[model samples]
Target: MTTCGDGRLTCDEETIDTIRERVLSDVSARAPFDAVTGNEDRVSDGAVSGDARATKTDREVAVSVTSLSKRFGDGADAVTAVDDVSFDAETGSIVGLLGPNGAGKTTLIKSVLGMVLPDEGTVEIRGIDVYDRPREAYTHVDAMLEGARNDYWRLTVRENLRYFATISGVDPDSVRDRHDRLLAQLGLAEKADVPVRDLSRGMKQKVSLASVLAGGATVVFLDEPTLGLDIESSRTLQRELRRLVEEEDLTVILSSHDMDVVETVCDRVLIMSAGKIIADDTVDSLLRETGLHCVQITSTDLDAQIVSTLRGQFDTFSANAREAGYQIEVTTDSDGLYALLALLRTSDVTLGRVRTVEPDLEDVFVDLTAGDRTPGER
Candidate 1:
């Protein structure tokens, strides 16, 4: 039960009553519960009461950002990191925050976490206004931001877990259970007694992830989690992340430059460039919208001359060769494919094989962000 900025009193108990009053007051209002109240007896008594459920489904938005903007400095020196970005993350889903380097993905994440103040607009976490109640609103969120990684070098892995759990006010018994589970899952069981300063980069990442999840917050934010990890460690992290989402019903907001990770992990994506969210949709939807795909061609004699000729024919052509043969990849339409084959034949370049590579979320991101170049771009 709480009161909003409008000074209207609302409670979980009187929610239905409030709805009823508002509905009856509207010209478009047609009470379906009329049969139960006997207001309209045109319906039969044996029929299901109008008090039956509403036809529309409930929309429970977990994260909502409206017209959010962030700027650094003043006047001509000011730089905008986020500009009027608006979107919502539905409950129990993973949303990816993606963009080119310096595209303001990190800025937006920090803004939502209350690390940086927005110049305009609102950020709401689980129905609580972050600007109005910073501490209270963030009580529902746990974020793993860059440069926030500070592990006690003197403490053992187990000791570090215990310390963070206590600081977060979680029960000791719960911490023990969670710590053990995370240790086994993250392959840190053997390193529990070892000092954190002795751990590898990948091991530190695992520990950080465990600590953030232990916060028991409904929403979790991860930034470039797989950036420095080897293939095996990255795979393990992805597997555990999927398990957490399915079993714990955790909602994740991921910011990463790894396209493969974003494609495989996220349900939806937000593409930003120059402080603005230019595109927002499901990963598959973005792929469909761009119609971007790739074609891979293998050749026996992939000489520099052949590569240069191919590059000239197709704007997106690239080639890689090894001891066996040369591999060429081109991104274009079907008609362009025919033109590519004709050029190869005319150039006398031997083709070993050809295959079409399905476009993933990364292709959509690159295609969209390529046109928007930022000053001092990375």
Candidate 2:
């Protein structure tokens, strides 16, 4: 295996070959693409022609985990990485898995993907038990871990896609149209024939994503998918993921430290802490339930005395000097907002501008995981 600069590991060519041989041996009797393309009556602009997106009622449970747990070492040195966690991901939706460092996010994901066996509980992919029927469970699943590491640097962009497709029990010729469409949708058509080693870091990341989808897998796991992308490239990739989920009925389990991306793209988020899920809800619901509000007040009258007074009263008080005046921000509840306003009025502080700051996913995450020491992982 090779390690990327970001400290994530990717499979080497020898490891890739081993995995391919194992998959081929296990799924030798699997049917071809024709047998999988049952939805031949629908069409979408970015998806294969005649492949309609599945409706909510028609969507099946793509992944399920029940009471999963994993631990490392023995006796007094035992460390639990995943603690009886359970969740289900439906087809045509993206579920975000988030946590701070050493929060068991990696171990939980590895257990779900069958890379590491859990000490307890079970995992099912497409209703097939992963441990009981590894071949069948993995047939509809694919993963792109550690950003751009999933692609072969020595191979051309198109060749990498075809190679992955072949390993997934697919015929490259059969998915030729799909590959073309993927390349076009990801802005990689121009680089299709170019070697991956010759592309920019961001382009290589996109190639990794395209190769993962080339196999036409129904369920995919992505780790830091937009690591090297610029703002525009990140937005483009987000749009493509939404399109794939809506048009091709793909299921995605996305794990990333970029809270902005998760907030924008995920249907639901699962937050882990200390080997346990601390929060699970839609982004909007989590924001609403936080009951935290931030207010920013700009005033030339915000002298050092007033700023110091406000800091003493509010735990989340912060002040920055602006061109025209001093801007002060305070995070409080609804009741505290009234108290703050009353204090300002009594201090004879004339506010030039008052704005309510919207709380985002990052704020919520930090609030939830505060005071937790970094632990776990053997």
Candidate 3:
């Protein structure tokens, strides 16, 4: 007569602890502009906030795109990668791009970078048209498209930085002082003479970052800087990023899935689904706007009938039986939690450990992109 799965529901003590233990995070790269950032960002309670308190008074439009679109193949094989999308990225900020699989994040970023020409729409960087004026547009920009692969495996860390800077037209000699400083700041100074092939993946990633920053580009587009990085390494990268934006007067546009990077680093988030942007706002605002808070409870006598009653009374409710009792998770707004409390009081089940679960990037991501889909006749 037991249906609660024999007390097999294990508690998530991992997600239950400090922030560093949970590194993968969300998106909201609004001011803190593009992708990835450093520490020194203070997050509290159950919400994710902006990385910086910088105002708009000193900010300037860095990258602008109006009505962008892209598609792959044609007819039956056609896959609409990016729909008519448009948004502005501010100077000296990190913006995180998030989406489900097949989402047009990559296509949108590529079209903006001019790597993939948009069938329709235009992309502008620092007032230069990226599509029409590639040279003039690229002069103020640089990108680390393939993460660690962006470097030459045989080149020394310093050699890679100098070589990339020169190819990108940033005079290595003129920026030598700046280059050395960046290496030191990014914790790559000691590894400067080490061959790229000899460095760990995380070190290589940092090298890629130094190369990008060394160019003195105003805007940098990073696909996923935190990918394959460990907790400490990721934290290091995030810290260096914050320093770069603050000291270098740099602007970044990053796309990543790690919620820790997104929620902690990005100033605002742009969530794309299918081929369109579904949500755009600061992380704190987005979480608050979702209006959903969760509560976990254990009951001694919860049965199928009582579980159904609870589910009927709430939009987001789930219960599972265990040998000790019933484990229930109910997600609702403020008033709904109150209603739930009232319902529980009158029920025959003996409830225990009813506490609020802090809403984080994962919750916001699931709710916003729950049904992320394209609105075309398929």
Best lDDT goes to which candidate?
A: 2
**Minimal lDDT window, size 10, model 1:** 40-49
Order of models, best lDDT first: 2, 3, 1
Could you arrange the candidates by TM-score from highest to lowest?
Answer: 2, 1, 3
TM-score for candidate 3, residues paired by index: 0.75
User: Could you tell which candidate, 1 or 3, scores higher by TM-score?
Assistant: 1
The global C-alpha lDDT for each of the candidates, from Candidate 1 onward, is 0.72, 0.83, 0.73
Write down the TM-score of every candidate: 0.76, 0.80, 0.75
RMSD of every candidate to native, in Å, equals 15.5, 6.5, 15.6
Instruction: Evaluate model 2: give its TM-score.
Output: 0.80
Q: Can you write out model 1's per-residue Cα lDDT over 302-354, one digit (the tens) per residue?
A: 77787887788665667887777688898865687778778788878777887
Residue-level lDDT tens digits of model 3 in 112-193: 8877888999888877787777876776677887888888766678767766655554445555677787788778889998
| Better by lDDT, candidate 2 or 1 | 2
Q: Per-residue alpha-carbon lDDT of model 2 for 1-378, expressed as tens digits?
A: 889999998997789768755654544344344333333321222232332335667777888999999999899988888899999999889999999888889999999889999999999987889999887678678899888889878778988887777667676666779889889988999999898989999999999999998878788999999999999999999999998888778899999999999999999999998889999899999999988899889998888888888889875778998775689988876887899999999989898999999978887887787655685432
Model 1: how far is 213 from its true place, Å?
1.0
Worst 10 residues of 3 by lDDT: 23-32
lDDT computed for candidate 2: 0.83
